[model samples]
Target: MDPDVAMWLGSTLLTIGALAVGVTVHLIGLGRVAPTFALGLPGRRLRTDAATFALTHRAATPLTWLAAAIAAVAAVGALAAGLGTGIGEWAVLAVLSAIVLVIGLTLATWRAHTALGDDALLDDSTNGPLRPGAD
Candidate 1:
């Protein structure tokens, strides 16, 4: 029955909703561009471009869902708070929003970096191996 709680929940819901929609749109786009990602890299190239793409797709799916869950919980809490008392709710909402946003963004970037690192690369010019794994 707190206004602050309501706002926080609302913000969490809003962030999660935004994240889900963004991810859905991204997946659709990825599917459409599958060919480009599937293309193999030129000489001295080891793995297909699809490797990174696939990795990202896989990572995003679960992460997006996790984020949605968080958002949903926040939304419910916020709604409950709204029905109670309205206090210094704005601050709570702002803080929560910022924290969640940072966490989400950090996770996304970390996934990409991890995937990239996992992708083995080779230097054709030197006929030397860069990172051993894929193509």
Candidate 2:
């Protein structure tokens, strides 16, 4: 493939993968933290399962942050590649799309964490929950 095409393709794939990972992390974090928050009153069992999953997976918060960082980096790389490529406006548009995805993911994660009042439910030691019968 041409160098420009290769750059555009690689950057686009990276951006897309980053966005997917970020979104997945966000959903997992949400499910773990406030599984019942938006589930309404019909899914008691699902809520319990979500809480259990959340407790068991204490790394969700950190993973979310990592995902967001990766997404941001990918977006930047995509933008740079787009500017350097001769693929015309489509490349720039793709870069802009990546930027938008990164921004949206960042904002959503921020809002969720803010609403929860905490990024993670981890204990002081970060080993697990502090209270007994927890996790």
Candidate 3:
């Protein structure tokens, strides 16, 4: 196969991967279940099992968007440099996606903790000094 054709094919695959990620994120963000959910588990629990799921899902929105952008640029690079179909191209995009995911998760966790803290004051009279409760 011609190098140009191979490169083009690689571009196609990258585009497909990026598009897949984008559509998946949109559907999930919009409250639409991903296709994989149906095949993975029952009761749709996988999608909304955690109390922090909504928060995580919200966080995933930006990461996936960013992932697509990174992947698109990476694909173009691969296509132009004849680096398509190479691990280097895939790895670059994968690493970017991973970075985005990790940062997004970290941010989400922090945001959730801040937004939904325990907010409960325990009766620490036993541990702390008496507060005139006469206990």
Candidate 4:
């Protein structure tokens, strides 16, 4: 397996996993997108406070976007350079990128989670009349 292949594979896998989580969480509770994303991935319950959910969603939204971008770039880079290399090298890069992505992404999520409050307000408030009841 080429390094590029490995990189691409690694990136693809991570993105898929991350996006899958995103979609699943979104489906679980569209109204509580922020809290579900912050807590659900690790297995936690969503808070009932609308303000709290909005705060975290706003805070984490940027980081989450960045992480998604990073993952996409890393994957593309991996795929591009992996055309004719061994898996070992790609694996190394993949592992490193994965670590960084996870760390950075998790920090973003945590910040968003911690900053949430019962009265915080955000433009993209994840809480609204539609939140209380969902599929």
Name model 2 segments beyond 4 Å from true: 32-49, 55-59, 78-135
What is the C-alpha local distance difference test score of each model? 0.47, 0.51, 0.48, 0.53
Weakest lDDT window of 10 consecutive positions for candidate 3: 126-135
Highest lDDT against the true fold, candidate: 4
lDDT of 4 by residue, 40-129 (tens): 433132354553454445446556656656765665565555554666656665666576568756876675556544343333456432
Q: How many pairs of residues collide in each model?
A: 10, 0, 0, 4
lDDT of candidate 2 at residue 126, scale 0 to 100: 70
Query: What TM-score does each of the candidates earn?
Result: 0.50, 0.40, 0.50, 0.59
- The superposed Cα distance between candidate 2 and the true structure at residue 88, in angstroms, equals 20
Q: Choose the strongest candidate by TM-score.
A: 4
> Could you tell me the lDDT of residue 79 within candidate 3?
63
Candidate 2 local lDDT, 25-46, one digit each (tens): 5555445345554422222332
Q: Write the per-residue lDDT of candidate 1 for residues 1-135, one digit (tens) a residue.
A: 555555665566576665654465255224433424233111212124443454444444455456555655555555455556453454464456456644754665455445444533335666433422323
Model 3 TM: 0.50
3 or 4, greater by TM-score: 4
Of 3 and 4, the candidate ahead on lDDT is 4
Sorted on lDDT, best first, the list reads: 4, 2, 3, 1
